[model samples]
Target: MSTLTKQDPFSRLLESAPTNFTAARILAKECYLAQGIPLAKAEEYKFTNVGKKLEQNITNFFNADSFEVSEELIKSSIFEGFKGDVLVFSNGKFLPAHSAKIKGIEVSVLSEKSDLALGSIAKPEKDPFAALNQASFENGIFISIPKKAQILKPILLLFFNQANEGQVIQPRVWIEAGDFAEVTFIEQSVSLGETAYFVNKVVELKGGINTQLHYYRLQNEGKPVLEVSNIESDIQKDARFTSVTISLSGDLVRNNLSFNLLGSNSEGNMYGIYLLNGKSHVDNHTNVDHTIPHAESHELYKGILADQSRGVFNGKIFVRQDAQKTNAFQQNNNILLSDDAIINTKPQLEIWADDVKCSHGCTVGQLDEEALFYLQARGIDKMQAKGLLLYAFAGEVLEKIQEESFRTYCDTLIQERLGSKF
Candidate 1:
């Protein structure tokens, strides 16, 4: 069965193009012009509408300048002084001057010939957004942690918008952790303006044998911006990788995440919570691929949609041949605050391995009326009663977060969304 009944015309252009350039600048421009912003008719883009938003010729307005960001702006968006190496990008350009170095990590801005040193990291061949990011990125941060090294502090990558005038920006990040390396990383994206613009960013991560990574992404871009992110992680044998995403703001947001278990005895976990209100739209699309034997993966995504907002969750797990003993489970649950609120959730599993255990499920409904009424009967007002019920709904996912600070931050965000003093 085909996901789409019709073929996409833009895909044809990519089929005819050459694949030699590392950045593929010209190819991306050609695709942008030929496709002229994809519509729902596009096969892979059936659920997204940014292609329609790009018709404003905003990409052409991007310009590179020797810009500098102020200290006040950095302090305003900083994520609690994480201990590991820190890389700061103001707008689209990397600011090495603002970055702090660590003893055991190698971090720098990517330029020509740097890819030679960043071994075994496969650059995408057909992803136009990846190509566009590579071509237009003023500077990209590249991190390499040596084998057997454990980072003491979480590496922070902060993307701050310093542009006085609103402009479209694309930033790229590439990371490689060697065998036996262990690290924790946190990425926070904050915009300064109420300007209307688009952000198409990509982050690629690679973990070698026996490696471990704890990754977290926090996005708070306000109401006028469109936030789109592509996060892909490749895990090797006997390795562990975890990704946590907490979505709180953005007029329209989409996160595409994928995890590949390429070696035996590898494990992966994907956890996310999104809070939506007003007329906002938040979508989370993810896939977990188990290709080797004795691999395991678990995914749970929960959302709180209020007002007339909409939320979407699509998760798929694939187990390939010879991937015996594969264990995978996926679940998506949501609480809709109003009759006007909407949620679309789909959980899927495709297994070619006969000796595996896999299951998936989803639920979309209002808060538990009994629980709300019980709280209300205990002297709680209608709004406060609903807030208590909704908070408990998302607390299951929040409890899994290991870092106390991150957990507390997410708690405060949830409280603010509920608009209750408690």
Candidate 2:
């Protein structure tokens, strides 16, 4: 047995997992047993020790009998001013009562009869968290958008975690958009109690030709929660896929986002922002692969860390030999607000095509003293001045959000996290 399997939480989670989705579950279990959990020495997890965090924080699998979702709790969890389809999950179990139905789109729980492209894009064999989620997820959500259908309203997925004891929750989401289909998705997570818990989430998205898919994720759980999420997407010919991740607070958080441009003329955009304070820690890792000619990808991630917080950003762009004429750009920037705050940023580009345009860069520094002096000279208080500059620095990535209401909502959260009155 591996060291991970000996852990109480991992063992209990495996033993409690349902035997449904046998094929995928067996494969994922085998892969997880072979790979175990990544250690600090591993190249992919050098900066962020997720395994240690999980071992230290999580104690057991969630006990469903310990908590129940109330109507008031559901109401309070809904996003303000958002009138769209909502799918609510409490303790990783889907709640049909609190969800709304939408026309022209199919939403259902994962089952044997479901027409699923489960392992098409996401390879659990390569990622331990994904493998654990695939092996242990109770019942995940599956969404399908028919060909040529355009849904104007964005779909919201709300995940709430509440437990009396330290536990673990695994949530899985699979989305497929047929050719020429267009849709948007918003995923938000909330913790209901002060107890420490672990959430391992995996999302797989498949886009068909000429399809447009937008995904936005918000992580603002309490400081006692530890979260690790993976989002994998594949875009076909003429399709455009955009993803935005905004992380506000958590004890330990890691986001792994990847996009594969599988067809010509496909485009992918990734934007992320993390505002961390206290002893919070957040890490964002993104990968973009251009496998065909005429594909394009853009990535931008920024962070504002204060107190004893720590942040990490690792982004890579790969252009294969056949990916001629591909254009890719990547950038990561961070600001450390205190001497104890730390950030590790790495932007990498690997291009084998001679006819491609690619660039990658990263920056880590404190707030510009000259700019702060100028603001202070204008009679603005130091705190407000610092807020203004940090907000401006973070606004670049926030502006990439195309949805107006959602953008305003995110702006509000950022301001609050920054403690900016202006």
Cα lDDT listed for each candidate: 0.74, 0.85
Displacement of the residue 290 alpha carbon in candidate 1, Å: 1.0
Per-residue CA lDDT of model 1 for 1-422, tens digit only, reads 11111443334334444333344545454544444444567645566665655443233346334357777877766645233556788775678899887788888776633434221332333345554454455556778899999886777787876443435566777788999999888888777667766677778899999998988888778677776777888999999999989888887787888898999999999999999888888889898989999999999999998898888898989999889999998999998887899888888898899999999999888778798788888898999887777788878888767666667777787877775556
| Poorest 10 consecutive residues by lDDT, candidate 2 | 1-10
State each model's C-alpha RMSD to the native.
4.5, 1.8
Where does candidate 1 clash, by residue pair? none
The parts of candidate 1 lying over 4 Å away from their true place are 1-36, 56-66, 79-85, 116-126, 163-166
The reply for model 2, stretches above 4 Å from the true place, is 5-9, 62-67, 112-115
TM-score against native, each model: 0.88, 0.96
Model 2 Cα lDDT, one tens digit per residue, 203-321: 99999999999999888998888888889999999999999999988899989999999999999999999999999999998989999999999999999989999999989899999
lDDT of 2: 0.85
